[model samples]
Target: MKEKKSAKTYKPLQILAIGAHPDDVELCCAGTLARCIQRGDKVTIALACRGDSASMDLPGDKISSIRSREALHAARVLGAELIEMGMSDYGVDLTLQAKQVFSDVIRQTAPDVIFTHYHTDYGSDHNNTFVLVRDAALAATVGNFRTSRPAVSKSPLIYMWEPLAGYGFQPEIYVDITETFSRKVKMLNCHRSQREWFRRRGGVDFLDYIEVVAKFRGYQSGVRFAEGFIPLKNWANIGARSVLP
Candidate 1:
């Protein structure tokens, strides 16, 4: 009998994972990000919003402040740096301001790969972020595109993390994440403020749901735990490297 072929492994020099809110990155792709960091890849975590409007009990600015701190802790746990784009939580849009913010992030990070929300996410902010990041990723590579910073010589490979709603997302690939699953949960626990929000919604244990999703995706791909992703299409020959195994 023939032995099974090994999955492709990638050690990208740098990776940036962007989320619509403070905890979105942890909820979606923290395992993958954690794995990247373990392999000595420099990882940068970016959020389109400070998650200011996520809670009504706290004022917008206060919520933003709290979430920013929480995000920093989470990033530290994952061995990644954090960048908060300072957009409103639910008001993220595909405006010029958003485009420029995302472009600036791409230029500043200069990551070999970027992971962000899927275009078809159920949340308005998530979908809008997808639009801006997609545009900005392209804009960051254009020499004539006047951004605050200089353009990068090349655009990084972009991957869509699984959507928050999970209903409409069609994952095309899976990365086995058995080794980093616990660390991913620990990283997510850093977002202390969001616990009540999830607790009130479906009475679901947030961490358990995340683990279950990873396990389900892993089962689909013959692994013990995993994170799924769908590559952005229509880009010729870019994003061909596999960062997940």
Candidate 2:
């Protein structure tokens, strides 16, 4: 008898995660991204802003420089590439220029999956980041959009990570990050400047907050730790295959 054939194998995927501020990705989806890296997938973290206004004491330029260094450290922890858009804090908008810049990033990365902020998130910057990512993902596919990079042949699947405090948002998917939770914490810890800012301004222990959110999501999903996400279910963004790791 002829030998039976094994199942076909697929190559690793390129993932892109976008956030409004330097530590946003680490706060919401670092565990998930770490899990993806463990699976041999490539990941990129893009920040819409440098978080120049995050500090109460430091000047805009100084804080921006500090946050950039922190973000670079966090990206190294997660084994992901980092992209900074150089937009001002609270300046993310739905302008044509913003869309083109975002589109160029999408084109250059050519991601198979994208993770971004939810549309109804609390802050204006977060909400606008959602709009920009949503529009640019489509714009990147159009031949005549005219970005620095060439248009992508297909639009990538988009998933919105959980909002702040999981407010006004329900997840349609959950990724079990129990095994990678420590790595996630390490990535977040790299944002030392943000930790100090939160402690001094709000008396909040940033790491504790992250743990609580992860545990809550974990309980909901019957995992020790997990990250929640909502897919952009529009026809163009839906796909038959499961891409999350």
Candidate 3:
């Protein structure tokens, strides 16, 4: 098989994928992260919380710790760094404090591109994740945002990932993940507890459902496997071609 081209053609970019919970990024954009890693780009996985509420049957703290470990393991699988924002599970709110924390992460990382949840998602955390990232992405570029860290040199290109299956998500970009799909699945499998939680609580095969979604997205993009995103277009996004898939 031919080796994939390193992402060296474009300037090395810091890419951040933020989600409401540990498994959210894995379920949505792990394939894209894996591809970025293959191409030698820097990748960071940020979760709004430790996903403690993912399984209420277990103690919250215990599940939070377990989920954090799982998130770290998944990050390793994709050669990315994991950043936990320490919000309580099912408790993500669109508050000033939350915005500050989210802004701090963006400024500290100085990412060139950000992928986050779609604001129209069913879950509150998912919807709030979108709001927080959108606001923080803007605040991170302003000198007077009053965040913990210094402002980023410029705002990054922000893109929102596909929402839950039934949500009204219309994708404007599609990343072909044909070569990285297996690794994406492997990374998602690191959340072993989530799989068990889904079965016991939701009665769903987690991996199976995600793979099906990936396949469906791939079909939309004319690829064997793919991930879809909608660009959060604005003045900052003009002429930013390096971040596009």
- Highest lDDT among the candidates is held by which one? 2
- Model 1 over residues 1-245: C-alpha lDDT tens digits? 99887985654577889889999999999998888887889999999887877674889888889889989998999889999888786879878877888999999998778888888888889988888878888888888887789998777777898876478776888887899999899998998888776777667678888978998898898989999998877572166556553
**Model 1: number of backbone collisions:** 0
Candidate-wise lDDT, in order: 0.84, 0.92, 0.87
Ranking by lDDT: 2, 3, 1
* Candidate 2 residue-wise lDDT, 144-187, digit = tens: 99988889988899999988888888888999999999998998
lDDT of 2: 0.92
Which residue pairs clash in candidate 1? none
Give the better candidate number (2 or 3) by TM-score: 2
lDDT of 3 by residue, 1-245 (tens): 99998775666789999999999999888888888887778999999987877775788899999999999999998889989999987889999999999999999899988998988988899999998888888888888989778888878888888886837887878999999999988998999999999898878887888789888988999999888988887776434585654
TM-score of each: 0.91, 0.97, 0.93
Alpha-carbon RMSD, each predicted model = 4.6, 1.2, 4.3
Off by over 4 Å in 3: 1-8, 237-242
Each candidate's number of clashing pairs is 0, 0, 0
